[model samples]
Target: MAAFRIGEAAQLLGVSADTVRRWVDGGRLPAARDEHGHRVITGTDLAAFARSLAESPSLAGSSARNRLRGIVTAIVKDRVMAQVDIQAGPYRVVSLMSREAVDEMDLRVGSLAVAVIKSTAVVVEKP
Candidate 1:
């Protein structure tokens, strides 16, 4: 059974360690003291809590499983294409699309957008 310390859990969840501590303190997330007397979250419990946090009613019909809601941080447009940057939680998602599509969507800095990612091959790495 794998367990994560508060700092590790926070890094995985893209939040600060203090936020994880608060969640544990407020009973939003379950934790147990390890043998060393430090709080730790079981991997199963952490997965459930992460799922709960990711549920979004607005994205109910999306076919893509990976959806990140974020504000548009930057947009660069040329004559034919545009590049958009979004800060979603602790992740930065970038997209390049046709300028016509960008104009039709009225995408601009500070606009709210959702990045729907559908990838067949994704590489996962551990540090």
Candidate 2:
């Protein structure tokens, strides 16, 4: 039942604000005008749109469903490996991948990207 502004939607989608505007303008995403005459996206609409995007084969792999969209905070590259860090709201997700993959994805600091996480097991520790 929550509503989000264009900027907030962009941050959640790991895209630029202009991209969200374009989506709204192009009718790809649904939005409504607020009292301030600003575009507002409902959480339901945004989630559906995100699901569509995530289902795309080219954008995110089909196996990974837990997608956290955010901006790249840091990237450390070595000869064959690279460590990428993303800040997704209050969560920070890090992943290590091949240098080639990193370069192919054009992952750099400040770049908008999504961290697709597919984990099989999660361990819990008592306090």
Candidate 3:
């Protein structure tokens, strides 16, 4: 039964506050006012909306279920290995790979990339 303010919902959804306001105004997102007259969205509603927004098809032929589209923010490389950082919405994904693979993919700062994640274990916490 957790609730989030408009700003918090926007941050969680990786959108501007104004955009979230518009969604509420346009009836695309359901919201209610708190005692202080601040608009709040329930965590359940937000999760449904997030799922709807993620309905788009992922990369063709990719089996990974988690895909985060983002821009490359940094790249640190040594003779053998490289670290690539991608800013995907409100999340930052970091990957360590071989320098040869980096060169083969030509990944660089400002490059658009998707972080495909497939794991058996994931950690979730309540805030």
Candidate 4:
């Protein structure tokens, strides 16, 4: 079985380290301590949590009708910012956001995610 540290889980879930800690502390996401007494989460559990987060309506909202679901093709992250590219059918949506946000959302190539657009604005809401 493969297990990831809390930081890794946070990266995979696209959430902050504190957020992941809160989830674990609150019991929203299940975790177990490793031999080093550090919190670790399994890949399966992380995937399931990601799915729930992706499906939650509050994150995407009901008014946003222009939602594109697709696979992430590329991601470029710097010290403070990150660029993510997603391919949704014939359309490609690119977004630039905080490096923390990108890390928290675990946005990476070959991962499934969604791009929400409203009017001229584009929001990258990935799972």
lDDT (Cα, tens digit) per residue for candidate 1, span 1-127: 9999999999888788999999999999999999999999999999999999888686678767788779999999999999999999889999999999999999999999999999999999986
lDDT of 3: 0.93
Ranked by TM-score, the better of candidates 3 and 4 is: 3
Task: Assess every candidate by TM-score.
Answer: 0.77, 0.59, 0.84, 0.48
Candidate 4 lDDT by residue in tens digits, 9-89:
876665678999999999999999899999999889988988777675665547666667889999998899999999876
**lDDT (CA) for every model shown?**
0.94, 0.90, 0.93, 0.84
Better of 2 and 3 by TM-score: 3
RMSD of 2: 6.1
| Clash count per candidate | 0, 0, 0, 4
Q: What are the per-residue Cα lDDT tens digits for candidate 3 across 17-107?
A: 9999999999999999999999999999999999998776654566676888899999999999999999999799999999999999999
Clashing pairs in 2: none
> lDDT of model 4 at residue 10?
77
- Write down the lDDT that model 2 would get: 0.90
